[model samples]
Target chain A: MSAIPQFGNWLSRRLQGSAAASNRRGYNAARHTDMAAEVWVIVRIFYAASLMVSFAFITPTLWKIAIAEPMLEPRWPVFWIHWVDVRLGATVLLIANMAAAFFAAPLYRKRWPRVALAITFFLSVALMLSRGYVNNSFHIWLWLTFFFAWLPDSDSRASLMDRRFRYDSVRVFVWATGTVLLFYTLSGIAKFIGAVPMNADKLSSVAPEALAHLVTKQLMISGDESVFGGLLVQLPTLGWPVYMLVIYIEIFALFALFRPALIPVFGWALMAFHIGIWFFMGILFPMQPLQVLLLLVWSPLALRPFSARGAIEQLPLLGSVVFWRRTKPNVSLMKFWWADEWPLFTVIAALTFLDVLPELVKRLLAAM
Target chain B: MNASHSRKNRGAILPLIRATTREKELDMGRKNNRFKAGFAAILVSAYTLVGGYGASFNFPEIFPFFNWALFSFPAKIYNEWVVQVIAIDGDRLSEPADVHLIDRFDHFGAGEGKVLREWGKSVEQGDLEAAQAHRSLFENLYRRSGAEQVRYRLVLRRSNPVQRWEHGTVLSETVEGEFTWVKDSGEQP
Candidate 1:
């Protein structure tokens, strides 16, 4: 009994000592813990923006008149749900899609926030199925929602600008980057594969005429009778370069996977590409450019300002080099994929630059 | 005596605070990072696998990824499909009269002619099933729009969309397919 009191007194003194120590180191510890959380907040904001752009930008009822028949197969297993009046069903889907999108914004990293994300995914799928025409671009949104919904909620609802990096933050970055890269690779594969119809004479090859024809057909179907597309039809020679350029961009988009710094450049190129498509084809892929913005460019712009000269940037030539080094990258492919071999990878990347000059020369010669 | 009593109170509370903080650290430390990442990974992989399979097979209603294969077409094929509703006054088919509700720019028509346009496309694509599926609905709307006896005639013409867009409608070689549905007489199946 006497020994128990003595032990309690000793424990109390130890606790008091540690508590004082914690107060002294509190700032650094708090900052370190919050780094991941801050990054997550940025990502959450981007997700919300993407949701708004995708679900809210278009008039929900625009497709109602075009839905002639109920879909042959509904995405949900509840077959009887399809029995509702088509217009009423479509309206419900549209309303639900918008509601979920509005609520899922900010991705609070809590249970209810996750539920909202889930609802958004299901409703988006339902809306796509409800229409006579479904855009495949929405698939990436669904996959993103699925990943985000699984993230653990934050302890406190602090501002996302807090510079905390956490386990979940890393996971989201990896998953999102992987998904975007996979999409680019798949697009490239689609072009290279024999799936596209070729001319009868050139059974294996895609003739320029055939590609030109398809562009014209797509534009007409979309109600875009643009003069630019008409000009392409009149000048058959322009078709080859345009088609090849499209293929090259689609393939090269894969490079962004290895070098995250190239994402902003890629995003701008994608926007230009989409804008061109809109002008010529009269079809707008709204979600794609938005996806590029949220996935690639938003992170660095949020984290680092170009004008903020770092310690390295102040040094002459070395400072410029350091400035590039200090620029906050969302993820370095070399560091993430092979941290030990990053130096070797950098060397390899440098070596490839030599080949680039020769390749450009050959291309110019060929064009001539 | 008063100062000693105050110190005792704080001393009692300090151990509890330390114990609680330690408990929180243990809880946070034990979080299964792998499991969290694994769940998302498995879900994305499974979805992509199923989606890719469905897309490759060209299954209708499947989320299409490769629907527009780039650089594969050898020729451009552009076709325009038009649907004209002609009223049948006894045996004489009147000069293709417009169905006001379906074609006219009203709340019912919405000015876009979406139904007629899509219906025409279905016919042009040789998707007879899709074309036939909405016959009753179209006829009902036509009757509601004040057409007592009418038949829908589909006219398909091919032209480059770019040319068509720039230079008004130049419909070529009309191929006609007609579906007759009269309000009192019922639909001609």
Candidate 2:
């Protein structure tokens, strides 16, 4: 009996010592922050908005006939589910997903409902995708939403205005950012490695020609011939450069990941690239506009404020405010990553207004 | 002496910081998350390798996005629009639907058209394996579209991608392949 008591005490001490060592090493609270109130608020809001917008655009018409009609005989399901089971599951999940998207739109820091919403959202997307030939464009959106679902619930708004940053939220935000960056980098690497090598026959290369082929076919089938892509197909020199630029963007995305400040710049540039794709190619990647609205606008670094006259005064050649008394607030070049800043968010929201507002309007009009 | 002192020190803290249920749950959650993150990183790295070396190494099929071959444009410069011509004649149809036919079957779902078009392209590109793999499924799909006899044609409309609009002319249209429709008796439209 005495030996057993002694052994218990020894075991308890060992466990406690290990726990203390772990705590001292700071493994439990790595990259903890209670900062970036404004950015966090915007992220939470935009994330919720993306979900709402996605649900709104979902045409239930895609799966309605599925209940009566069997799935394509040749199609592969991601997992084995009976035909009747799939129909019932699809109906239930679709309805559940829409409801979750609606209820979780605010994205309050509630654990249970948020988790429930995330699971349903994931299942619904998987079902939707598995039903057809997968369009990989939607994959990023689905995964990003799933990441946000796992984020620790908080009064995100309270954190936004509060000066002290929540370490947990910041960690989650950083992980989300890294994951998105990783996705882009992987896409780039894939493109570079899989690139159709340059050869005597230009069309034999898949890099630029395939994209052109796909878009032109879509445009021609739709009975529209006036797009710039049609013109590019005619001009090899101009088109080749554009194709190279795409491969570069996909591969060089790795560099953009480490430079946190440049994330916004990369996001905007990618957005422009996608817009060009939409113009030259008739296929609009549906999730892209929403992604730009939510993720691209967020920057962990605060932008340095600028003043024109002050800049002119500092220039050697230019007639300056040096000719007169200069007045400008000196903005610090370095800022705490956790500091709240709204200018970038405001600017991005303004730019994306033309892109997303129309869809919001269309959805409203359809409802009406 | 040092061991005894350390033991005494551990006992003082151990009683003060007993592993509560909440603490234990947090620890488990953290461990679970770390495992998930590590696993995800490994999967991503594996996918990257597969994308880069898939042609050299015979790996299982990956997602089209990860295939990397999606962007591989051929080096030889010839502009051509690959088009599919389907001719169908059926029992209750008002008339035989030719290349430009619009029907209820066409509008059923977007994926069907896209995948079918891709399959035709793959065949035209001389992917024998793809064509062979999809033969039965393709037949079934054709039947499901409510067509009795279907004539399938893959035509290449040759033009300069850059100057296609400028010339407003097809240099040549080559028929890559044409197949007569044979019905599988067991399959119903």
Top model number, lDDT: 1
The model with the greatest DockQ is 2
What global local distance difference test value does model 2 have? 0.48
lDDT tens digits, residue span A246-342, model 1? 6555544544433333445556666666677766666567776766666665533222232233312322122323333444244563342343233
Give me the chain B TM-score of candidate 1.
0.49
TM-score of each: 0.58, 0.60
- For candidate 1, give the lDDT: 0.49
Please write out the lDDT profile of model 1 over residues B35-141, one tens digit for every residue.
Answer: 44345434434444444444433324344232333334333334445555654534444466334424331223221234455566566678877666544434544
Q: At residue A54, what lDDT does model 1 achieve?
A: 45
Q: Which stretches of candidate 1 lie over 4 Å from their true place?
A: A1-42, A47-59, A62-73, A83-96, A157-165, A194-196, A199-211, A234-236, A252-255, A299-368, B1-59, B63-74, B78-131, B134-151, B155-176, B180-188
Candidate 1's displacement at residue B91, Å, is: 16
> At residue A157, what lDDT does model 2 achieve?
55
Q: Candidate 1 docking category?
A: incorrect
